[model samples]
Target: MSTRLPALITHLAHRHVSVPGLLHSGFGGTEIDQAHRDVLDHLAHAVTAERHRVDEAAQTVMRGATTVIQALSHQMRSKIDEMQHRYDDPGLAQHLLGLDHLNEQNLRHIQGTGVLCGAWPGLTHADSHLGDIVAGAQSRIRGYHRVQVTSQMEAPVAVVARAVEPIAITVAELLANALHHTHGTLAIDVSLHQAESGACVVIDDAGVGMHSDETEFASRLLSGQRTILLTELGDPPRTGFAKISRLMRQYGFSVSIDKSSPYGGVRAVVFIPGNLLTLLDEHTHPMSAMAPLPRPTSPTRTGTLPTGDAGGTGGTGEGLPRRRRRDAQPAGHLPAARPDQAPTPEETQATWSAFQAGTASGRAASRTDHLEGNH
Candidate 1:
């Protein structure tokens, strides 16, 4: 029954040998007989339990499969009917005929029943839910203007409950940053992979490249720096990169910011390794492993970030004492910013004036890139 009962019986035999040492005065043959009987009884119970568990699991799987197959069968028939009669025009007949053939093929596959994976319906539903969350983000950013935009996605998508939500938030943050920082068009690339070892999600955006120093500063957020004042501009809705960086840390992922392309501004990539999503086993190798695995205390921006090296004076702004500013810019410098909004600032009287004056737009852009200071 669990394939281990025989081994268990062998173990009990070893224990039976010990019985004689504890009961020296007992009749040797009778003692052996009782111990043998006890072991046999336990072995029987264990086998029965394993078999029952196996049977129950098999029945549940069959029930789920049947339900999905039946639903698929009905859906396929409806599709066939719709395709066969929806178009009456002679010119469209060829296309309709092809669709009908495809529909029939699908119907056959469903009716085969064997086509469904062992626990297909449940898996399908789970995948569908993840697809929706992913699609929703795509939909929200669909119409945002871009200098250039492109995307790629790969799958067997590890959609774990523990890290999924945090990763989603991190993705939204990076996507928004791409839209806000890039000039004309932006390109986005996303990859999700599950291997013999683990899983990973990689997102890349081509837009405005960030200064090597500043990008490193943001990335090292989790390593040695705990809390970062997100914006020079005042509080709440005005959250800057620091907040996003912290959130990524909460789930054991790190953010790397670099130039989007050979040409320009900033690119932020969020890397979630497989083990953080779940516990690893004997076979789990990291699919998206980073070399010199970062220590939780190491500055995030140390090596991969444009920020200065870990020992260099430049990147570790996190360790320096923050200079108090009595006349610093008020937190309300940009009132419309939010944790997930595209990096775009709301059109305000000041922004319009700057755009029209020409010089102001350049200066405003400069101030944005210098977010963490030229240091």
Candidate 2:
């Protein structure tokens, strides 16, 4: 036994480390503990590093996807417009007009998509009026005619160059929600108020007011206190509020749903601090003059459908209940957006419906990939 013990010790100490190295060697108990800790530290750092890489890759993919969608959306819109103008058939032209509206709605969705991914490649520095921004938002929403934008800005108030599109997108989300919830033709009022602290975009709707949990959710989003995840947005994902929340966080803004409108509906207030504003330069033409907003030729109907409402009666122009609920948005995570050019009329008349429906599979298939985690 004695001989065996010496032999065992000799074998164990065959590669014995020097005294200084023993403190870090794998053989010593303390050294073994330290080695384990070192390995853990390395693993932690590797995980952190990998997470950053994944995040960066995701952003890149999102940015690219937004760019492509904007392009397709713009092209289709232009085709619809040109077909409307050149063709003499009023009936066919009307159909084209409908397609054009869908294109605009899709554009709005894409813009929101861009907002989520932090990719706004559009006009960044514009000397834009508060009304111009409101108009832009109104133009993007489905029921633009139903939204009345009133500005009490005494001076020629401008959204600073960096803030123009982000402000527009934020306003669009607020306006879109307001329009979505109300009776098909029920009017929404968006009033703009500017003060020293910041600018305010107040949206009042006549739809059913929000529940407490919904209100809390909206508040969290608008304040950017919560981070958005794809899983949280519900299946088929209503990305509108989530999109605006990201922009609000990035752009140094705040939105709240704490107030009730005079019409017994939801009142959403978007607070844009003074840093986002600039006095309109005399040389600037704020309005882009793309096209006039369309009036609602059809009567305002009840049962208005939301964009992604697949349940109940399917998300159509009509089917949503009049008392549709409103959601909230938060913090300023705004990305500057530059949308692609819009459609020509021919594309709207003949080809748009098919393209819109997913007949064009190549690009459409990738849409999910780009927006997978974006919601």
Candidate 3:
């Protein structure tokens, strides 16, 4: 009877261990096992609920941090704008421009964080030309000079007011990624193509292309099929693709980065559907009436300098008067000036002087307009 009792206890112990496996495999067992499975299911659900709560808490903390940074950046930018106005010396003007550019890059990072936390792009502008939108994006990054934009639209294409900022942010992130991966003075080619269905902004780089796995991961992220946590972004946190994904899902546009570039690098294409597009004249607002676009500046080395840096010469070097002409050119076509006929130094200096004068005049006009509007 003692031996039989020991065997019975061992049988009961083995049955208890099998309950969890039965629950996992969705199998039914003895009534006692079923009761054990019910308890285990409840515990599992509790754990999942706790994990969700923690994720929400972490996102809340990140959103709060981004909000604080954004407010500080706005005040700093206002001060920089005032300084830009107070100074007329070319060298000082250049330095002020660099500061402004740096602030813009900082703002991009902050805005990206906010967006990933389910916040809007935060600035609203009147409907704007697609070319201008692309140029506006080009002005935001560290390697603006390396970007060569060519537009092939038969007519002007403008983004609807609702989509303007989100598209610009996506393009800027793409340009930054291209700049980070490419080396030397190789040009990053950005081409705009318009079709009956929509308009596409195609960015091609000259760096080594992504591996199959990297491409697959990027495809999944851009598709917005998977939920991403900030913790999953890896050390130092790359929020670019994640931010782009959020914007893509929220807005109706789509992005594809799965293709290879002719330049032996990755090719990324952003397509804005016809529903989100308009003519330049449609729903247009006065420049002063709309949220001000980022003022064009001479490209300076802002943000982390990617490996194989291009000497950051897209515009005048750091601490130089802002040159709006180079970047402000319409994205639809290349400059008419022949490459062989480079402007003489005297001609270049004259152009710079004219640019500075125009900038001052424009500011004065804007102030006057504001006063008149108030009256």
Candidate 4:
């Protein structure tokens, strides 16, 4: 029996372990305790072995991800170099203009598919197109205009694409505004830094800066103000500022406009949340094997149809009562709105209609146009 017990333990240890089954045998007090101890030791060793295996697998996965990203970056850099060298070619400008169309197609695809993994390729392609455009534009607009750029933290291709697209758009708008509104030498200084909260990208322009009050108003509008103030200067036109504001809001980032700048121009500070940077970082360390958090569900909308009448109950037909009867309700319970501020049926209908009209108009005009040809 003694000899058989060792053999049994050895066999069970090599095979699948069942601690309870191992302890269940004809044995005395000491033997029973020893068997229990052996079972526990086997389990601990198995757990350690499994954990080591998992760690090695994770490391391998991470190495693979790093390799893929490095290769993608190398290819992009090589292509950009080739394009830079071809800049002087007589037909280079025309070819880049053609690539601009391809850039638009890639952007549209990214929007439709929501495939962020393809972001670098799409962005690098678009960057090449823009680089050509910038070169062409510079030849004509090159006077005393100043441009400075600084960046920190290795930017992943995907991050570069997502970050640069909106920035370029905003900068283009600013440049156009400066060219038309301001005179004399214009300069732009851009800096990117990593903060404890997140990454911050600042752009400063030495053009005719906005007035103090106007800058404050613009700052407020950028910080989640849906309705912009139309100043006594008359309608400011929604061509540039309004569009920039809308895009910034959609991206869940904060944009601030300040009257102060070293160059005596308007300063724009864009705070990029670390989440996007983290996504790029994860791509660098994909072997973690930990699943990312699910995206939060967007808020549900009350799709109430527009209807007339001040306080009639049947408007929109979903049985949402227009009035809250205090007597019919439980004591101390309150409705979401105060009795005075509660929107009247007419007001609600008018507001909803306006919103719907604006939404339709925005969608129709949102198709991005990359203006070609030098000014």
**lDDT of the candidates, in the order given:** 0.38, 0.58, 0.65, 0.39
TM-score of each: 0.34, 0.58, 0.68, 0.36
Q: Indicate the worst ten consecutive residues by lDDT in candidate 2.
A: 328-337
- The residue-by-residue lDDT of candidate 2 on 1-375, one tens digit each, is 333334433443232422123333456567566665575456556655665566567766767787677777867865665675577564586476677767778887876777676665243444455666676567666766567555544334456656666777778888887766777646777776656566688888877877887776676666677556544566677777788788777778777775578767789888877666555332333223321221122354332211232222333434222221122122211112222433466654443343233222212212322232332
Name the weakest run of 10 consecutive residues (lDDT summed) in model 3: 366-375
Candidate 3, superposed: residue stretches over 4 Å from native = 1-44, 282-375
Give the Å error, residue 168, model 4: 4.1
Prediction RMSDs, each to the true structure: 23.1, 17.5, 14.0, 27.8
**Backbone Cα, N, C clashes tallied per candidate:** 21, 39, 3, 1
lDDT by residue for model 1 (1-375), tens: 233345554554333332222234364568675675576577768865665566456645544555555455445545644553464454454444345445434433332222121222111111111222233233224222221121122221233444544454455556656665654433444433333333334444455566666565555553536433212213433333544554554557666666654334454555655444332111222211110111122333322222122222234334432212223223212112233443322332232222223221111221111111111
Q: Between candidates 1 and 2, name the one with more favorable lDDT.
A: 2
| Candidate 2 deviant stretches above 4 angstroms | 1-63, 80-96, 121-125, 281-375
* TM-score of candidate 1 versus the correct structure, residues matched by position: 0.34
Candidate achieving the largest lDDT? 3
**Deviation from native of the Cα of residue 23 in model 4, angstroms:** 99
lDDT of 2 at 91: 57
Model 1 misplaced stretches (Cα beyond 4 Å): 1-133, 142-155, 193-198, 222-224, 229-240, 260-265, 276-375
Question: Which of the two, 1 or 4, has more lDDT?
Answer: 4
Candidate no. 4 TM-score: 0.36
- Better model by TM-score: candidate 1 vs candidate 4: 4
lDDT string for model 3 (43-146, tens) is: 55665566567777888777767766766776786687687667656666656666777887998888788788876666666566677778767767886657
